[model samples]
Target: MATSPQTRKAIADSENALRDTLWTDAADRLWAHKTSGGFVTTPKTMPYVCRILDEMSKDHPLASTYEALWSYTWANNAFLRFNKPDDVTFAAGFSGQRGRRTLLERMRRLQLLGFIETQPNGNETFGFIFLPNPHAVLFRHQAGQGTPLPDPAPKGLSTHILPASWNAFVARALDLGCKDVKLLLNPPPPAPVSAAAPAVPAALTSPKVLRRRPKAAAKA
Candidate 1:
């Protein structure tokens, strides 16, 4: 029996709708977690997220890696996920002979490019984290003036492992006039100083200068 074109179209539409709903649900959960401070480190803002997606989509070699990241994000219900590179590769739908190595290489490439960050999980496993440009516009719209920047992802969630080449990547991003995108590269602020600590004496705080007048007089 031949399936009618109308029936096929309906099925396709249904799949699309289902996928959209899943993505929306996942995003909502992540947003809720962020609001509740479940993520010690902040997830990338929507704008930054969108920008990263755009860049990854344009890179053919990174297509599978990008999909893997999306899957992990959905599975974790947040931007942080605890999984080995092999696990992520399998989750991305890569199977069969040689698929694992290929996927692992792709993951490494993404990390080298600064699209993803990873930290050790103590048991020889790794925790992967996504770093996208922050959504400054959305943040401003929702937070209004004087709003603090987003917090870093929780230490438990990600070690915030950065590659040694990260400096070069940041420099390139800034040179490209991508100030907003480069915001993610900045280090988090230091923890606030304790108010209970004793203050240093004013005299000790002042700069000291050595007098050279005696030496000059001796020379003359």
Candidate 2:
């Protein structure tokens, strides 16, 4: 059955509200981190995190999983470790939607892309620890240093390309505090240049011209 326009609008509005909530939560957490010295060594990391979250699209296959994991890590300021695959699976929200193997594969892809690093516990009873490095990933993305791995699943695949104006979005997000949220959705204009002072005319600057020829005609 075809969906009505009102239904589509309602769906869009809900999605947008969810997105806003996610970012606002991220921003608030980042502010808390800032106050608590979470970024003392790497103050630059906070902005990168905000930029990545702002640029992330809901259509990405691992968007929810990644966001959830990042939020967990950011709040705790530590790696998320699990003793069982079920723990990791549930945390990533892949219990019914996907299997543990798929979760591991997605994590491996993220690791390869520099977005995450994993360390095995060496005990079969203990699963692994996932260390998220969104700042490093954002830097690598900006520098074109790594290739984004394609998702094996057919549904909701994304190229994961960073837009050229990512920095501008980050700046606006930090300075404006979500006042003009639509600005981040659109492409940013070129860097603003200061307006130069108006040029003075040569005619105005030079001395006034004297009419000496009229006097010669009167003599003739």
lDDT (CA) per prediction: 0.50, 0.54
TM for candidate 1 is 0.33
Q: Any residue pairs clashing in model 2, and if so which?
A: none
TM-score of each: 0.33, 0.42
Q: In lDDT terms, how accurate is model 2? A: 0.54
Which window of ten consecutive residues has the lowest lDDT sum in model 1? 153-162
Q: Residues 13-58, candidate 2, lDDT per residue (tens digit)? A: 8886887787867444545644676442323335545445434432
Error of 1 at 166 (Å): 21
Model 1, CA-based lDDT: 0.50
Question: What is the Cα root-mean-square deviation between model 2 and the actual structure?
Answer: 16.0
- lDDT at 66 for candidate 1? 56
